[model samples]
Target: MAGNFKMLAKTFYGFEPILAKELRDLGAGHVKEGVRNVTFEGDTGFMYKANLCLRTALKIFKPIATFKVLNEKELYQNVNRINWPKYFDCGKTFAIDTTMHSDVFNNSLFVSQKVKDALVDKFRAVERQRPNVNTHDPDVRINVHLYKNFCSVSLDSSGSSLHQRGYRIATNIAPINEVLAAGLLLSSGWDGETDFMDPMCGSGTFLIEAGMIACNIPANINRENYAFMHWNDYDDELHNKIVDASLNKTREFHYKIIGYDKAPSAVRKAQENVDNANLSEYISIERKDFFRTEKPIDAKLHMVFNPPYGERLQIDVEDFYSKIGDTLKQQYPDTNAWLITSNLEALKYVGLRPSRKIKTYNGKLESRLVKYEMYAGSKKAKFNPDGQEAKS
Candidate 1:
């Protein structure tokens, strides 16, 4: 049955295009990018594939209904009008999460409460049984998005964020989100053909994701559960088939992935995470200060890392960044280094002109993913401190 339905994949800012491209590649139809979200059409199997393969998506939402509501009363009525029994049984536990961008709705909690009441009433009115609300770990999670007078009700297919790929159990003070790290690496055109390094690898997230991307491994291969698995319409056989098919597409990677951290604790944590991801064969971690180390590989090296931004790690911001610049300029030749940091003022101390800078966010702090390319050989790399190219 080719039942076409709309689904929205939510992602961090600056990742909608990547998410949309992922959906398109995964056999989705009518792929369209929106603000921090990508909407697409796919059948049930395709939905499972998207939840498993997408590297940048945080959540995949299957919107069951959309309507216009001027006030809470209308919202309650419309929520009750939905065929809730079609999605789940009354014995299952569910949760309602609400987001509002309307002036009329002052409280999202209130909206969620109303929607829950509507659902409970609908189920109880017919079968004399109602689904209990379990906020922490629900069998089914529902999303209600209200933009002005419009409301879209969706069922979350990806549970607890796809960033929780069920591999990383250890982390440092400022561990990067797995999805964000993967997206940043993809944005930098990492195909895993060359040697990859994360000089400040906190917990080896980039290394693991890079290995997965190189080997064509599904992003959520290690994940044990998703919200869709608990739905009444979930097809276990279809999901297993999708998993096997995706596994069949796995390819071999030839290059090495390495991680370096000055802190011994960070190194240990990274190694533990790498082992958990079962990527120890492709990745190596060392407890060495990036500033004191030279480029390990003579060939073109691709580096992506989230260095200390002074806020998380207690290090001198200006001097630390200056050391980073000195290390890269003196020791790291024939390399392209990419790093994300929230400290704009500290970035100036690096004294090297970033050839490329993309605006991104690390949580609430606005940051930039900057790139410095050191040409391989006697050709000296150019550094424009002002970010403008200087005439020869």
Candidate 2:
């Protein structure tokens, strides 16, 4: 515990608990959930493990400095006082991202510029050179958080957002975010016990994530890089050992994971992405219309998917939703179907009452993740007010 330090794992809204549970399960100390982030204590090895194993985390940050600042001058002085050379060398390029929730700083971009100037000035004064700023792709990324009169500076351990798992080489027009997909699966209580499916599996994001969750595979097993690798104190041998240990802990999953997409191009892309993730054996993608298909398995099925919200994919909103309800009620019984949709007005057209409705956001669009439970037998299945099996 001597080398352990506090770290924050940022996530999407409603995912704090999931991320906290993941950290605690991975042996993190002092785990606490806050809004869209979770803070915990871990050593360097654990940090590596967190980056590799956290399915719901968007990014991981190691806070290096926290101080009080009243104005831009104090911010510049405090930021410049830190030993910038200790983190990374002048040869490495760096970028600063600032987020401010304060009355003092009106523009976050200005704060970022000031922080960047301070860091560059410090490096120039000491080493006679400064790291270049690369906003697009930086070797090192620093995060600045300002609230009221306090500032928190952190070093980003995960470079590109962890959602970019590096396995999704091919994506459809509206592929679901990997973190969101995993969170939805976890929220649905999907522990790989029953058969899993995504009827509208655009790029197989849900199928692949479900497979990983089932098999206890590290979420970023296919990811090849992290910002920590470029840090000054990074230990390659330790990182490799951590990776090996995580890989060795992967358990075997023996349930079927299937995906279906009506479009041939989506089917091809989903298969390609699944293959890229090395999970083709666990997941199978078929080019078939979900409305025309019955349950692929006779046993209980757990379904999670992101159907078109009528924005990207054009369709008759009410008719499509009604078809979804009809298909599940009449054809695909014994299934717990969960879907996220931004079209709240259209959700009423689904006919079946949702057992659960959770508030969530999908890229600025406030959405609801709803669940419809279909019983095994026709007599047992719940029907709408119309008293019809498959209502129009």
- Global local distance difference test of model 2: 0.92
lDDT of 1: 0.90
| lDDT tens digits by residue: candidate 2, 64-170 | 99999899999999999989999999989899998889868889999999999999999999999999999999999999999988999999999999998988988
lDDT of 2 at 243: 90
Residues 1-392, candidate 1, lDDT per residue (tens digit)?
25989999999999888888888888899999999999999898999999999999999999988999988899989999998988889878899999889867989999999999999999988778998999999999999999988999999999789999989999888889999998999989999889999998888899999999999899999999999998888999999999999999999888889899888998999899889988999999999989889989878899998988889688899899999999888888888999999999988999899999999899999999999988675234455898775543
Residue range with the least summed lDDT across 10 consecutive positions in model 2: 376-385
RMSD of each: 4.4, 3.4
Clashes of each: 0, 0
TM agreement with the true structure for every prediction: 0.95, 0.96
All models: lDDT? 0.90, 0.92
lDDT of 1 at 114: 96
Clashing pairs in 2: none
Q: How close is candidate 2 to the true structure, as a TM-score?
A: 0.96
